[model samples]
Target: MTRTGSGHPRHSRPGDGQDSRRRRPPPKGRSPRRRRRPPVARTATANGLPSGPRGHWFLVAAGLLVVAAALTLDGYATGVVGETRPGPPAGFASAESAEVRRGGPVVNVTGDRPTSVRLPGRTVALTFNDGPDPEWTPQVLDVLARHGAKATFFVVGSKVARHPDLARRIVAEGHELGNHTYSHADLTAVPGWRLRLESSLTQRALAGATGLHTTLARPPHSPAPPAVTDLQWAAMKELAAEGHLVVLTDLDAEDWSRPGTAEIVASSLPAGGEGAVVTMRDSGGDRRQTVEALDLVLERLKGEDYRAVTVTEAIGMPSAHRRAGAVDRFFGAALNLAQRASETFTGVLRWALFIAGALTLGRFGFFIVLAGVHAHRTRGGTRRRNAVGGWPSPPPVTVIVPAYNEAAGIQATLRSLVATSYRGELEILVVDDGSTDGTANLAAAPGFPGVRVIRRPNGGKPAALNTGIAQASHELLIMVDGDTVFERATIGRLVRRFADPAIGAVSGNTKVGNRRGAIGRWQHIEYVIGFNLDRRAFELLDCMATVPGAVGAFRRSALVALGGVSGDTLAEDTDLTMALCRAGWRVVYEENAVAWTEAPASLGELWRQRYRWCYGTLQAMWKHRRAVVERNPFGRRCLGYLTLFHVLLPLLAPVVDLMAIYAIAVDDPLPVVAAWAGFVLVQGLIGWYALLLDGERASALWILPLQQFVYRQLMYLVVIQSLATALLGVRLRWHGIRREGTFNEFTQAAGRSLPAGGPRRP
Candidate 1:
């Protein structure tokens, strides 16, 4: 569990750390077998002034997928997914050299104003907002009238126009008018023209209500664009020339959430009480609590004999330590970002990882919906009875099943291929990888006829796949692992996408074949959400990085052009996808084409599989760094996606993690708890979508908290171990994935690279 002193994946047998069998076995109903997998190492501006908001969730998904791919990259890879920034610049040459320098002590208020004001008699101020509500505004006014208290009402233009009577009632009821803009949109998104529009419309709406003569405005959502306050202040000056003032808020009831009356009372009423806030929200929907809270504040203030008055009454404000501290904290953050950007290029990579992952996922969502729409328009679908024998013929296809000591799975895989729905001119090739098991003999038996067996010394998986691809007679090459099986229509659907000619490869959605165990179920979620959905986004981005090796179709021309997969990278499939992209070919992802493949059913197997993948990714990125600066469209697109999302940002993810842990474990309670809660909330929001996409809606809520321990910590370990080896150039001796014995066989860890997964040749 402790860090193994930061080295490349330890090239020892699974038992070397502690037992015997390297892999666990395949699932139930399948023969016992061991197989090996090759080891590989690896948003948004709601913009102001933009004509449209565009993107939505599809673009967001694209960004997530790109980051996910960068996650696959080995730490050594450059550009987006790999390490790009140095951790905070170490104690800069001088604090003066900082890019974002700290300014003077945080100012509390521009002018002296009293923290409190008292008059000889009792004094109090009342606030209302988001009014012009036909249902609630009048009731609020009536209550104020009964209490004989003067109040202020903040109104939005649209609502004022809709219910002018309500606005007039407030004025008639002795309440002052305040501006709250026109459309009620978040003001953070309003700037320049819209900024002016906000003030203009509010005045117009107010003119319609009572008078065009008044002045005052409160931003919607307490959100103001850059310099919004200053701009408003300047406008206020012009209005003041005619005698008017602008008001800002210090007290908030958070009434927008409709906290019940009691909760509202608790939040708004001060310890001693009588309260004054320049702004508030409409409270009638559920304001019994708010009303109760107001009464409570009134009681306390009356008891304490303190006075609450308008800004005009308070002459000198209290000390500003808290507000100053906030500015100081902002300064610290700016410093931290600057420092980190210098050390290893963390900013660029973090940005890359975030951008790439998001784009990848967003694009996937887009295509899924797009394809769905396209299908609906064409009267094409998985459920419409297939109009006879599935869609139109998709040329001929050669199904290749690569096997090494895969006796347990060999027959099953061959059988599955033979049973496929595209019964026309189909060929099955089982390239045997010098199986110690009698995998070859079983293939020669009578039950399988059209299946051909080609035996070769095990150089590696790429070698096996290359041999099969070479002997294939058809241009449409389908690759399915011996331990995997396709749904009846998977083959036909996958091949059909190639009709576009531009698509050189089409990935089949791979699901977990074994779902009985907890480990397997966890992996099931990973595959559906993390892998398949991610690919959809990747395809949409034109950077479908890896057409999964588990089950996919590739154009034979594209396959041959890439020189039949090289041993240069552990993940030849991923490497091939990149090469194909570089070769100007596109890879498409088909969610309907599902192939169920066996997951490593155990933790040890899973780590090794992931280690190889990470290592291979790093190797791939290193091989292709030239794409970053290259002018080719594919090169530019891939590089931008990689550098911004994968390389810089994620390498620093552990930084974010450690900082979070640091924030949580601190001695003080407030900041730590705040950090913990914020982190969890953000992650939960994201996890909700990921789980919803993965079809584990029930688990999403629970999964967020659990991830911090199980998934998060484990991820840090993977990153550390992967990085050490990657940066140090340590080589992984493990040859590739060796299957486990039957899922029920219960074999222990054995050989160096080969796990127990491969079926022993019977």
Candidate 2:
């Protein structure tokens, strides 16, 4: 081996041997080299651990829990059914005496002895149930006010909370208010604790809405006292123990069944003008009939010289409403505020779902149309080139592999490069960035005679690549990662693109080599469906964003003019490609030039790798944000697409997911499920088409549905964390993936059969 003036080893050729007897001193300005420290063995736990504090995940979980609780409360409050269903007629208990069973509708059991009372002759009490409706309650109140009649409204607490103004208007208009339970749940069907809870929440709602609590309670679906069942009596007794005066009805108009207005009005008139309490509804359904019946009933009663009064007035009892305490008012107000906030949040999520769906579908269509056009153009170009006998004479090329502790795969990488079918003079440069695993020794072994190994301190991949570019003897260079393997024609296919002087870089198609596991299959699907398909589309638009490092060819002049591979961004490939595009050089994609790279096998490793990729891409996009306003294709096409589809759409995806859950909770799930199914079907079609274009089997797509449940969420979370990190101005270190040397076996086998100088050019 010979040394240049800079003390760096020159490119070694076949049969170049060092003199065993010569002992050379250290270079002029530098001391003898210190032994490199063995690289630390990173454990699986280390790979899985997050680089930042885990507190963010805790906060996210807590926030999700709070939202879930709020949605649950809202759903429970508004989704109750059967609130006005008629009770069974034959379930009355026989324990009650004839006097108690046949007495008045207002029953007081709060004292040692139970008491029942009826209205006096010619005095009627009108009571409305399931009320405070925004629509019909006001109409009912208007009719009563017109006739100077005072009635009672048994208000559902949820309805009152939602329409507090209506509750207040009832009191202002000289009517009485009574509790109908928080969610209009049936007292006989609920447990003792739930009954208590129902009463408590209703009181709080009343306090929040009207600043008062009612002692008059009406169990939902309660019938006249004569028909009270054993279970109903037990629940009424519990309410009495809680100091409530149970109010039952004397006459049920049954307007909830939408019976004719004539029947409703006839039912409201007491038998022979006897005093009675009549039940009607202002809510739970269309109540126009009830409103009209009330007007007619009032006119008829007035014709007979009968007067209408409130329940408490007709029963000779004091007011049922009292001012609420301060604590109840505060908590009730908080509940109202929380419910409103949850409703607002749900609305936002619905809008987000619509926007995300539009963007996603639009992107899918864009990829399909443009990618098809690109494929047609590429095939036509290939046909024309074949007619012209391809490149008359290929140019000399240098292949640079930057390695760091890559002894596990360096030999395989070198062997794969040596076996290339490229006709031109080919040089392989392995720049070992201070690896303690004998990476340089593996590259310079006896099996690979002409491969050159350059040793340098561990200054990172960008520095190592810069050193390789500086030392290369050819004007065309191809960069490859130490863990990637190439097809025999990969270099030839890549170099052929340089026939056009305007082409600055060519990105080869990258495939996953070890895609047997679930994680690997998911990545394989992404590479084909996401990265490569988008690349095809981008190439046609002339604004390709990234030329992957695993296999990419570049004109050395173009690279040198831009100051080779800057370390300013972790995604150096994307940064460089963007710069080239902005500099007016065309960066294209070559689908036929394929390279196989190993993908992460474990979820932890995959998370780390993708987190770095996403965060770095964000950094690069920010660093080159000025391009958006520039008059170049990179700005007009590339940046716009990346921002809309990649950043904005992904950020909105979680809302779409939340909306699905909300629909199932408070709305119909069939529509949401149908939409999801349609989305999946469209995605499957796209994946199938992509596999056909890439010459892969469609069997791998069976995992696509499962990906939605786990892989998709993981990616969304990555985007969120990346955005957070970017917003916080946090600096992230480069994450290194541990390689398993997946291609070693095949490359070793090929190496044994090939000649010492590698295979002959085809």
Query: Which one is best on lDDT?
Result: 2
Error of 2 at 100 (Å): 5.8
**Ten residues in a row with the worst lDDT in model 2?**
1-10
Off by over 4 Å in 1: 1-394, 643-647, 667-704, 734-762
Q: What tens digits encode model 1's per-residue C-alpha lDDT throughout 511-589?
A: 6656556666566555654566556566656777677877888999888987887656656777777788888888877
Q: Model 2, residue 505: displacement in angstroms?
A: 2.7
Clashes of each: 118, 0
lDDT of each: 0.55, 0.79
The residue-by-residue lDDT of candidate 2 on 579-640, one tens digit each, is: 89988899989898888777777887777777666776887788889998988857868878
Winner by TM-score: 2
